[model samples]
Target: MPISHQKALPSPIRVVLLNKPFQVLCQFNDEQGRQTLADFIHEPDIYAAGRLDRDSEGLLLLTNHGPLQHRLAEPSQKMPKTYWAQVEGDITEQALQQLQHGVQLKDGLTRPAKSQKIAPPKLWERNPPVRFRQNIPTSWLSLTITEGRNRQVRRMTAAVGFPTLRLIRVQIGPWKLTSLQPGESRDISGDPQIATLLKSPKRKSYRSPRSPQR
Candidate 1:
């Protein structure tokens, strides 16, 4: 049966947010060969709102709601997302300014962003802790972006000469990582505001022009 016909069935779309863990592939298949979201979310017919990279860890939204999914994932929408990054060198005032103004990349210049130095973070142990080079010092930074480009944060930090060692997304629009730990999943039925945010807007009614009477 076609998906449109299957709509008569009982299951309805719902919204979900997940804190994606490092090393897990964004997809459900293992053909290319790696752990995937299928290892976490098990609900039938559900899909992710957007994606996070396999090497990156943090807040990811998922939903069965199609319109909500399109709205969040579409590049034109430019949803805001914040990240905490640990980079390879000391964070200088000049470096912070450059990041705020936007760095040019092969794709073109990024939009202006908000950035600042942050205190060292206490995070879950990465399976293979990033390689250590004693001569180079590391510092923590907070950065936010309105666009979700491919490996964008990492590329941005590297463009500024501070290769990111650790990257964790902390916020997206109004959603937050809060208390959820990596590798864990949850159903988000408790928050009404979140529910409303995820709900699809009602479509406008249409009327046809009247035909001549016999």
Candidate 2:
């Protein structure tokens, strides 16, 4: 028998969940001297799976695995992402219904979303905190959707007549932000089931049965 060599498989992917802070860009580098992921994450090779706008805050996932990144970031995958939004008014049921049913924006009508009014979440104070309007009351909302259009969440709420004062992503697919504080991160590569979840067939929706109470 002739001797033969077999190629070894690459190491398992590394996934880092970050609690992105307000005003930090989702990218690693910037030319305008703005704050970016580089300021927080010192790890090499890992890239953000998806983006959280500079003005937005909270959970962000980074991975060194290209296929895994594509799986999570691709809009067609319909990986649900949940957010906690503080809006400009005492949100009404009609507005929540509009959000749940679908709201029309300049881009187009959004797909039906999971939307509900929630009590204000206990969170670290934001620098240059959301402007306080004594006469205008603000309300919190939990919104989940399966798309990644630019500023989609903000636009959706505005279309429903409530402008978002603050936005924080709380979950993505099977991952949760948990108790991570701003600029903190936790590596989840050791979780045995994560590979199974990532390699599973694409799902129409991947939201949790019960939303996390932050």
Candidate 3:
């Protein structure tokens, strides 16, 4: 029998949604002996879509599909990425408004962000926790922004005089970080979120997506 000429339907994209833990590099391999995505994920070939800093934790997506990765990783995509930031000192209404209106940074002015004080989200504890400052109280805030700048959340808080003590990404596009414990990851297939990643948010900006940390 002759081999059929019809091409098989493309296999569903392999998408890995990882709740990355603090202190782990976003990349799969690191030469500095630091922990990396490889420590938690042994899957081969797939690369991280966007970066989560070594000090930051939560929702980090990985995949081998280049176009899918580009859609999520591209700065032009304007996909809103949300974060929960535990900032030093109680956040003031003025500060929250400043954040919502956007603050001036060395990189210029950030696009307006969706920000509101939020109750501390129930989350896993970091191995080495943030310092306990008895004199200064901390508060949590949820922030959503369409631009991915370098240490943007931390910078935004600090710009408003609220230094971020801990940061965790809670969502990207339509995908939330719900229920996934630190360092846990799962395969996501055929979800509407995959389509949502490519859509742009309401605003526009020239800031590039966060580059992989060295």
In the range 10-33, model 3's lDDT, one tens digit per residue, is 756779889999899988777889
TM-score per prediction, in order, is: 0.84, 0.89, 0.87
Candidate 1 Cα deviation (angstroms), residue 122? 1.7
Per-residue lDDT tens digits for candidate 1, residues 1-214, read: 5656545565565767787888998877889778899988888788888888899998888877777787777655667899999999998888889889987776677778999999997888887888868899999999998776678899889998899998899888877888888977667646575567556464343211231121
Q: Pick by TM-score: which candidate is best?
A: 2
Better of 2 and 3 by TM-score: 2
Model 2: lDDT equals: 0.90
**Each prediction's Cα lDDT score?**
0.80, 0.90, 0.86
**TM-score for candidate 1:** 0.84
Over 1-214, each residue of candidate 2 has an lDDT whose tens digit, in order, gives 9877989989678999999999999999999999999999999999999899999999999999988898888777888999999999999999999999988776567889999999999999999799968899999999999888889899999998999999999999889999999999999988765677676898564333232221
Task: Give the Cα-based TM-score of candidate 3 against the true structure.
Answer: 0.87
RMSD of each: 9.7, 6.0, 3.8
Q: lDDT score of model 1?
A: 0.80
- Model 3: C-alpha RMSD to truth? 3.8
User: Which prediction has the highest lDDT against the true structure?
Assistant: 2
